[model samples]
Target: MRTSANPIIADLRDRIQHLEGSVARHKAILPFGVPEIDAHLPGGGLAYGALHEFAGGGVGTVDGAAAALFAAGIAARTKGKVVWCLARPDLFAPALAQVGLHPDRVIYVEAIREEFVLESFEEALRFGGLGAVVGEVVRLPMKASRRLQLAAEGSGTIGLMIRRWRRPTEVGDFGHPTAAATRWRISVLPSEPLPVPGIGRARWLAELIRVKAGESADFVVGACDVQGRISLSSDTADGSGETRRSVHSG
Candidate 1:
């Protein structure tokens, strides 16, 4: 196997090789750098070159913004430019910058229709040189998600699908199955208390709704900081804060 001086390129090559079945399943994983969250993942991090889904816990704008920022924070840690495909043109680039995904590093592809958004998303995933590809769509069918997953695996690029609905009724589509490796729902929570009398860091209820081979878990975490890192809530450790929950615990 050929190797590049750049570690990022090397990892990308490894992922492509793994997808071709030329090597063992040694795909690179992106750790959130939080042991509490990584402990639940199979590889102690999110697998590269895979499809993951994210959604808001409710139909409110606050929940939706939280979900978008969560995805942006994850993408910020990657190595290359990001391609964002969306049907709506309402994205605020400044808000993404606050989450560490600088607007300069992102390429926005605004399509008039959701179908075009999905098409752009899949094509970007196949391009292979991007840090990540994000698609904001209302519906993602199993077949479409499978194609996205395969494309991501082929190129070693991460694919993030944000399930957003214009109508509250469309939220029900989230219950449908997909080929994503993991599914998450984010809800805005009250910010952590401050030392004085000012606002503190934002808090979120991050729910791992599904994983490929891991149990679902819920955590109350502080919002991503300037470095795109999330800290576990201190109150949770003392049992005074919201209780963490896990489904089918062993």
Candidate 2:
């Protein structure tokens, strides 16, 4: 014998179940520009509230510059808000603008030490309104990384750590424990236009060294125009009858 109130209670439960399923589906999709990389990331792109880390190659200046460009592009597309915490005062303004991220849209926090940088990063991640926060650090402790991860999750913001090492150490080696949902190693590749002169476009080989949710690690993607625009590379014969290789990746 069902009470008269039973039907109303069952109806409310069904509505709650439907809402839960909708939220789950929304959580499962993240959109990164590159189809290949998106395929590897857990939710397609970087999850809204997760930490991602990027380690520089042996060379700091070039690698750091590239990493900044990449992070800036992601932030620009995020459309919420972006913050960049730098330990070093010399962040190339022109280079950052070239990556499609307007300089005005960024908030820069200059920190004196690595610890301060990480601490600031955690605070920013916990703030809840930013679309993404980037911190430049040499190495992050596993515990600290986990805290940033959880903070990002709680606030619905993406956190990025750019690992910069001064000396030749295995700090950015292939396998390492990090709280980052995904980790990438970025290296500069020789630009195209072989046997020619002039500053050729920069090329990068991005490796998905560690991913919390993804398949395959080794993949190559080009860092197109610095301003975050994607361009295709073409090989065409110049009027001089010379076959030169041109590089383009958008």
Candidate 3:
């Protein structure tokens, strides 16, 4: 004979499942899946409930694009939808897709100013339903950054802040301190040598300018692939256990 599940037991099971999911989300870490990089990061990857910052090495468009693609690749690896808040309307969806973040997975919010962009970014981070929240701003004051950081920590959603500058002098702003868990700089580099006389995969000089409780380092990495996966250059992948080290802090 078939018997119905007890209502009380069913309700208890549902509650247990919800708790488990919440715990997992709180403990989540998005790994780059590259040992060289992961080994240096705390918890072997980026903590889910944290804010990270990225900037281009130069004020040029190419370096800025590289920084954006780097963030896009990281967002692509995450689950759920991504909210991207930007003051500029020049985001290239096709390029993002090339780096593995498809347009379908993103909700683009074009704000009139950086303050508005930060507002949208904070809201998305607090909502917690999205996979990630990204905001592009020229500068992130400590007060504004603290608010975003708290929101992300409460919701267990990752926040990516891209620092875009129009003038070389503006690059000095990145040196200011903020609440970001880590700060990175990406610069375009020559592609790897190809077997034949054709262009090869793009590369970048990825500098870990600052990381929470960790020393700064730099790596020459291949550009994100179609699946949004990045790999260490052959020099770093040969198991020599070497990474370019620099002294810096957040």
Best of the candidates, TM-score? 1
Model 3, 19-126: lDDT tens digits are 778757686789999998887788899888899999998989999999999999999999999999999999999999998899999999999989999999999999
Ranking by TM-score: 1, 3, 2
lDDT tens digits, residue span 1-250, model 1: 2445588887899888765683234378999998878988778988888998999999987898899999999999998899999988989898899989998899999999999999999999999889999999999999999999989887888899999878899999999999999999999887888889999889888899888888788888999887678878875533566546577422
Q: What is the C-alpha lDDT of each candidate?
A: 0.87, 0.70, 0.90
lDDT of candidate 2 at residue 47, scale 0 to 100:
78
Candidate 2: lDDT of 125?
A: 91
- Candidate order by decreasing lDDT: 3, 1, 2
Candidate 1 wrong stretches, greater than 4 Å? 1-26, 237-243, 248-250
2 or 3, greater by lDDT: 3
* Pairs clashing within candidate 2: 30-45, 98-226, 98-227, 99-226, 99-227, 99-228, 100-227, 230-250, 231-250
Query: Using Cα atoms with residue i matched to residue i, what is each candidate's TM-score against the true structure?
Result: 0.88, 0.76, 0.87
For each predicted model, how many residue pairs clash, with residues at least 3 apart or on different chains?
Answer: 0, 9, 0
* Worst window of 10 by summed lDDT in candidate 3: 234-243
Stretches of model 2 off by over 4 angstroms after superposition: 1-30, 170-175, 194-200, 226-250
